[model samples]
Target: MRWTVLPLLVLVPLGYVIISAQQSRESGESKQLEAAARHLTFGYYPSSLQQRIYQVPIPYGAAHVGYLETNSWSTSVLYVQFTTTAGGLDTFLAKVGTSRAALRSGSSEISRSQAREASWTFSGPGPWSGTSMHKNGDKPDHAISVDLHDPDAPTVYVVSTVNFRYGFRDS
Candidate 1:
């Protein structure tokens, strides 16, 4: 009886330790999965120039620019902002407009909209693209907006990995 009781005491503690270690390992894996999902799905503000999403090349007679990526809970955005003279902004607009018109004529997937300051919005989807123009009320530079979204993401029980970059042509 004495021998049996001693062995039971050791066995119980050993079992407890094994269970605790397994729980710790599973908890760690769960945390890692959550982080990867956030990196794939979540987006934050693009406050630094180093965190760029893509670049756009202006057609005709304008300068090409690089875009910074940003997101909210439900949307993804690519944006470029630069300081230039009013004449430069006009040139930028004209070039972008010409490009959008070409895209529209070429593809039935494209659609257009109007934004403030004579900006244009064009949207299409193979990998989803949106274009627009903007100016902050106080800022000295005009902004160009383009965004992309994945058509198939997040249905659960399956994982998808998406990698993105832009092909920008020199103007």
Candidate 2:
């Protein structure tokens, strides 16, 4: 009887410790996500607007998450951006591909092969512009903004956005 009681005491505390650790881990992840979202400093995203958006699961090894949000329909959009030298984007893409995340459809075709892709015209040191739309089966369209070019020399900034949208338009 004494031995059984002692064992029960040990087991109960061990179980409680395990449960507490799990809860702590989940809490830590939530905090990390909040931190990641707060780190996006794009001028277009103000604190008020930033609060309106939330962070989504990020692919492993991706450098930074620029933006993330979802509409009432559950359609969502995410912007994943990286700043690296001309030779670096390919390496970034390769790492991202290894994570098996679905890169926004047309993004894979945009090569980082040149000092600047002929497809993109550098607008200035800020975000250069372009947009593309994709149709998702039975869902709303997805929009991808063109890679914004950095205005100055050694254009190392690039942004790739994946958007899922759904809504009725007034005819």
Candidate 3:
């Protein structure tokens, strides 16, 4: 009886230690991924078009952008895109209307379209969510898209296309 009790105590402690280590490792990985996501989304934008094409005002801390992909070997990669509308659509709208009005109206339309697109794309096996939305009173609409996959396969793929109306207020 004495020997049995001593072995049980040792095994239980060992199991606890193993679990604690695993938890810490997972926590660290999560933090790293979050930082990666931020870096990816904040720097992505279409290079072909000049930034002036987007017209709405871009407020500080009011934008987000990123995407993630997983390959068949279970490896994953994340990409982020960022851009601001300074002279494009916003400038055009300011010619005819208040900046605030243009921003709010434009953002409302963009948000609606984004929500619809996200829903349609994720209706199947993949899952997605809109993590943030900032309506700049109708000048420029700011938003973020987040996606994830459980048991992601090596060949799993994900892509995000972001559209911005910069200079124009309506439309």
Candidate 4:
């Protein structure tokens, strides 16, 4: 009876601690849900966690980096913007499975409905290169819009979306 009581006491505390840890982990993943409008964060470079989640690379010497995330019942979006060197820009584009030639000059490839979800405006464009990089039924689709007003430092805008339906669905 004594031994049974000791194991029960220790097991109860261990189970409680495990449950609490699981809750904290889930809560941390959902902090963005608190925002009703937009979950936008800007920095010089994306966090490692974000890089992993979004699978978007921040080229070396990237500046003016911005990351916007939106999630709802059916879709999750990640929009990233940054300014990097021309070579870096090319490398970045290639890594995302596209190239400079694929982008159209003086155009913004991001669809109007998609931009609205990120609370972004792709209008008032200059020398821009834009295109849809990749689309898969089960994987995230990526669209890129580049600002080439300053050829030396191109500002890249990319929208990566995980769509669960046929049409546009946002958070």
Give Cα distance to truth, residue 115, candidate 2, Å: 26
- Write model 4 residue lDDT over 1-171, tens digit each, in one string: 999999999999999999999999888775644344364566535567666656687898898887777777888788888889999998988877778889988788899887776667766546777988556555577888888889898888888877777653333
Q: Which window of ten consecutive residues has the lowest lDDT sum in model 1?
A: 153-162
TM-score of 1: 0.25
Q: Between the candidate structures 1 and 3, which one is better when assessed by TM-score?
A: 3
Evaluated with TM-score, which candidate comes out highest?
Answer: 4
Candidate 4 shows a clash count of 0
Clashing pairs in 1: none
Q: Is candidate 1 or candidate 3 better by lDDT?
A: 3
TM-score for each of the candidates? 0.25, 0.38, 0.28, 0.70
lDDT for position 125 in model 2: 43
Candidate scoring better on lDDT of 3 and 4: 4
Q: Is candidate 2 or candidate 4 better by TM-score?
A: 4
Give one digit per residue, the lDDT tens place, for model 2 in 119-141: 33334343433333333343223
Report the Cα lDDT for residue 95, model 2: 34
